[model samples]
Target: MKKQHIFQNALLTLLMLFGLAACQDREILTIENQSPAIVMDLSQEELFLDSNFPDNLALTIAWDVAKYSQPTELKYKVEASADESFEVPYVMGTVSGSQRVVSYTVGEMNKAAQTLGLTANEQGSLYFRVSSYIGEAGEYVTSTSNTTMLTITPYELEYPTFYLVGGATAAGWDAGQAIPLYKTSNMSYIYTYLTGNEPFRFLGQTNWNPLNYSIDQAGTRENYRYFKQVSSNLVQDGDENMKFTGTSGMYKISIDAATAVQSIEVEASPVAGWDFPEIYMVGSMNGWSATAPLTMAQVSPGIYEIVTPLGADAEFKFIGQKDWGDLEWGNILKDNHGYSGYVGPKGDNGNVKFVGNGGSYKVTVNLKAGTYTIVSQ
Candidate 1:
């Protein structure tokens, strides 16, 4: 009996020890090092416009609730003001939800401003601020993000309209002519235009700085100084009213015909007094080197012509240069007014015509058959 009692006490002690060990293991506490919470992210840090609101302006705001052990609901308030200090904000709106992402748009603001009888400011600035509040476990925490600034100004006006003149029945502007300008209350606006398949560079401007093409000389150039006019405004007015003409120059390009092409010709006039027109051919045939020096001979005065045998498939462009005193400049005069044509098999001849001179050579590439792409500079 004594031996049995000693064995039973040892087993009870072992069982108690095991239970204590299991309880200790269950008591272990795990602490999570939570990362910093992000409240919001503004799309742009600084937004500026010359006079009119940019047609393309969008802002995305993303936010999150405070990190906590329990579920939380986040509330957000967005406010905008004409002043950066935000002393007086126009309560734009408020949103509340579990959503982590939200977007605010200038288009919406514009509509609201219109209702308030406020014309889109030609030269106005605005700022935005967002504050977020999170309610967790009967407690509320709030966070705010840095303000973002937006500046608005009037639209700029100073682009000339490109017009098509003449050619064979196939001769017409293949590339769409007429670059429309955006309205600006001020004189400064971002200008962007597409350069057709042809390779071109900005020659000297007649009234603006020869090298930089700035309109500081608009007063002096009068009729020649092009102004930025909105597309809506330009369509109402004729191209002649713009007073801007395409640069006069000649371009030499090689056509990679899908099939055998015949009777390919390049034509252009001289810049009145300049002579010895140098034409550079750019395209896959010549590796699209705008600066690549190619030899061009004048078949006729002013009217520079060159003929080369093109394979079933080829692509190319020709650029003309003239010596103005000691400086070599683009043959803008000739290129602006010149036209190019090609005769494929079966009397299929199409002419590529000039569109505009937005400081870049623009041409319409009309093909009879097959496909071709602009190769290089």
Candidate 2:
């Protein structure tokens, strides 16, 4: 009887151990609510964004923490949409673990609202939702918060920045020295000289790899006659660079990045006589006289350069002709506009005030960038 009793207790102990092991296994693998209940709250009812106070707090948003089946971290992504149903969503950013609040500056909200279909000066409803993921790109599991609505009135904002880089451009394949261009909405433009027979490409950033854009990637390129594809350099997904073949002058290159595939448009600029035969410097050096004016060398297209001497505070201007016949360049300084650098083609403009010691200076004028630089050796 004693032996039977001991065996019965041992059997009970074994069953208990097996049950505990099963419980631990369930704890390790179980995931609770793959789609958790979420609620989002907004700080303000409306946002009339101002350009003056761009950094001011435009809005604050908060959301409930997502519940995970296990003790796992949750990732959150902020998404905006014009439609409450979120048929289309624009991801503003991703918030990593435990950050339940997000603050938006006037500038940030303005850009988001405009991008989400809110027009300038007109108020419209914008929907915000937070998407929660168990881990890594929402690959495992995902849940979305209830949408929050806010009436937003966005102001017009200036800009995006793009760069020009390649063998065809003046920067010449140097990504660090890539020429910068400005973009307003969809169109980015720059007026620059292109070297013939050499291929050029646009860089989305100041880096060489990954984001470089060329003719083949730009898709339906317009004014392709101005560019000839480099057939010799072509391989499958290789260097599809485009060589400039247009008339030898400055050209306006524009890209519309908003397209399905970015589109390119090139055209001859209306700027005239920028690449003239004899550009002269007749300033304080020659008593501002037209006669015996120092001749500037045409270093490149639309670019004139001269190495000359001047006196301290000696002011002078560049005339298209020897006698200043309308086309001229001078100090383009004014009330919050124009460059501290040299500019031209202005009426009754101020003479370029020489700020440095009077010595031999290499003065370079780039009509492309609409500026000039005076460098002292």
Clashes of 2: 2
- The lDDT leader among the candidates is 2
Which residue ranges in model 2 land beyond 4 Å of their true spot?
Answer: 1-28, 34-37, 161-166, 170-186, 190-193, 196-252, 257-377
Residue-wise lDDT of candidate 2 within 147-210, one digit each (tens)? 8888888887564356777666767778998877645466565656665556676666798655
- Model 1, range 1-377, lDDT digits (tens) per residue? 99999999999999999999999986774433243235457665543333244345555656555453334456667666666686665666667776656665555455333322233445455666666555533134355556766544323332222222112111222323311121122111111221222221111222222321112133423442332322211111121222122233322222111111111112221222223445444444455555653455554442343443333334444444321122222211223212223212111222222333223232222221111122222
* TM-score quality measure for candidate 1: 0.25
Query: Ten consecutive residues with minimal summed lDDT in candidate 1?
Result: 255-264
Instruction: Name the candidate that leads on TM-score.
Output: 2
What Cα-based lDDT does every candidate model obtain? 0.36, 0.68
**Candidate 2 residue pairs that clash:** 32-69, 329-344
Q: CA RMSD for every model?
A: 21.9, 11.8
State how far residue 276 of model 1 sits from its true place (Å).
85
Per-candidate TM-score against the hidden true structure:
0.25, 0.50
